[model samples]
Target: MVDADQTFVIVGGGLAGAKAAETLRAEGFRGRVILISDERDHPYERPPLSKGYLLGAADRDSALVHEAAWYAAHDIELHLGQTVDALDTAGRTVRLGDDGTLVHYDKLLLATGAEPRRLDVPGTGLAGVHHLRRFAHAERLKGVLAALGRDNGHLLIAGAGWIGLEVAAAGRHYGAEVTVVEPAPTPLHGVLGPELGNVFAELHREHGVRFQFGAKLTEIVGQDGLVLAARTEDGEEHPAHAVLAAIGAAPRTALAEAAGLELAPREQGGGIAVDASLRTSDPHVFAAGDVAAFPHPLFGVRLRVEHWANALNGGPAAARAMLGQEVVHDRVPYFFSDQYDLGMEYSGWAPPGAYDQVVIRGDAGKREFIAFWMKDGRVLAGMNVNVWDVTPAIQDLIRGGATVDPDALSDPRVPLDALVP
Candidate 1:
């Protein structure tokens, strides 16, 4: 077992890494804790990039997870713009950046997180094309938007996932004519499934956002260093002055792989295999947030959740394990979306191939509604659109393993509180 006073090295300064440092402190760890981040700045939240920050509803200072003096006062060292180059498991040291600075750690937390996946199509390197992964990436996109006078620019976004849609919403709010292209027949099908994706697709369409669903891009051509258009797999072409690639992100697991940690086959998504306790195959290291493919008790499978809630919750859960504290780390997977007149709250887990029921507790078409996914006579998952009021009741039902009565749940006049056990 690792000694308590030895140094703790956490690589990566995204949500997980920052929170892990905080967790280490909270768990009464007095060891030398260093957060090495390749980012030029200290840790910051990413959720605001797509909405509040992009819309000027908030500034960079408004989204920080901690006060400026918090890290200093906590004695957590911050290593900015320092990339960990190598991991020597035998030596228990990590090599950082081009300078080859090495640091020893009795225990290590590999919260390295993920990097955005890019389209390898031709002309992707052209100007006016971007990807959203860090604050810098979003800053570049926002700079492009600001320089082009916002609405005057025609923005073409590839992929219809959350980031793509969120960016589209931001661009739309700025009056830019946004076109989102998704090779899939429907957006977010791989996550929420096709039925719910349809709701989101319709929402975007109604907001005047154009869809190029099921269109595969063969090339992204440019003229004079500027993005001109995207050539479809079918030879069809569409004008695209600015192209934002929102395809997806892959775990930054190079160091973990180099350290001889057993890898979970990522043929499906390229995330790292982590046990229920967020421990990697290598006992000395643990992973969390977007990089971790953790076993789900409710889904009966492994899941890699990429959202604010997962990052916020997973970091500390892994920290508890690192501190020799047994943490169950169980929480209903939850995510929220705020776009154009809609505030969505989703909770719970869904079993695979179990397409059976959706019990609505309120008017779906109206501003407030709750939909529950039930299987095997128990509440399994739920999504509430503009129905924040009813979510606590639904959470209670899910927590207690109570099977919600569909007839009573759907009764127009019945309150969501009625579903509580």
Candidate 2:
């Protein structure tokens, strides 16, 4: 049994932090668990903020991962809108905002997560330019979409990642002529290979979305309190009434750095360092979610994943580590995205150029396909669009390090049950 009066303090009120709290309770931890958050609302799912929430398909309440009543019933204290000022790791206390009281913690989990990255270009501070990360940011975008009410108004998007493409699709659905600008030759060059990126480029182009591949943002011009257009180094000006910066997210490692914890280079500025057991340099402290770049034994490298699946799975692993459980938690890295009536799913871990064989489970022509990643005859990762039921099965196969015939797996007649161990 755990200490009755022990306190567990969790930073961030996103899925990772909330799941850590839930996992702690599920493991019979009856101690006081206080969840600190800078947002006004409780924990919520973030993936839908860019698509469903912006399109009016999902609401504020629906975005939340868990009900508020559930937290209250579980006796989980919420310090909403409380910004963590500092962390006294040696003292085992977290310093909060000016008025907020300092919290004492026996075990601290740093699930502080990440924030939307912004451009440093001129006119970026203009009224219409925005980046989506929190609920408030999405609300602002939704409001702009409602007020403008103009289809064909140029909406220029920076970056060509999944979120940027989703926003471009939404703008197209709203009848706005959208243009995507990326410094990379192809979209999602870091995750999906060039071939898949080419497919996405074609798909978006077919829907009337324009692409400025290999274009870089130089300046965001503003006039009289409104953004007018942005320029590229090539002296090209793209007229845009509004701009959505979807470059990427930077992990919130300010507190960790201030606390003098070990840090490592991530895709962004930095990600916190953690062992296979998910413990930081200071064993009493642990980090998870986007902030934690775990050392992946299977992938043979450390990875910082920013996905709902990762937050949900890693959160529990961090808690389990604190509870003295030995867990590798190197499960298949899975993620999903919902766009324009299309359900997309990604399962397992496929490093750059690691796959030698590509297996197609369904028909791509039918807009239903699952492309399995097989490296050295082992299934590493997959891309499943409109075919997500096999995600869990693929995840298990990857975890178990099992291999199957590529031809047999690709056939549409193959069952997910047969793919299982």
Instruction: Say which candidate scores most in TM-score.
Output: 2
Model 1's number of clashes is 0
- Identify the runs in model 2 with alpha carbons over 4 angstroms from their true place: 149-151, 267-269, 402-404, 414-421
lDDT of each: 0.80, 0.83
On the 0 to 100 scale, the lDDT of residue 228 in model 1 is: 80
- Candidate 1 error regions (>4 Å): 1-4, 147-151, 267-269, 412-421
Q: Which structure among the candidates has the greatest lDDT?
A: 2
Instruction: Please report how far candidate 1 places residue 379 from its true position, in Å.
Output: 2.6
Question: Candidate 2, residues 159-231: lDDT per residue as tens digits?
Answer: 9998898888778777787889998888887677665677678778888888898888988888997978989
Q: What's the CA RMSD for each of the models?
A: 2.2, 2.1
* Candidate 2, poorest ten consecutive residues by summed lDDT: 143-152
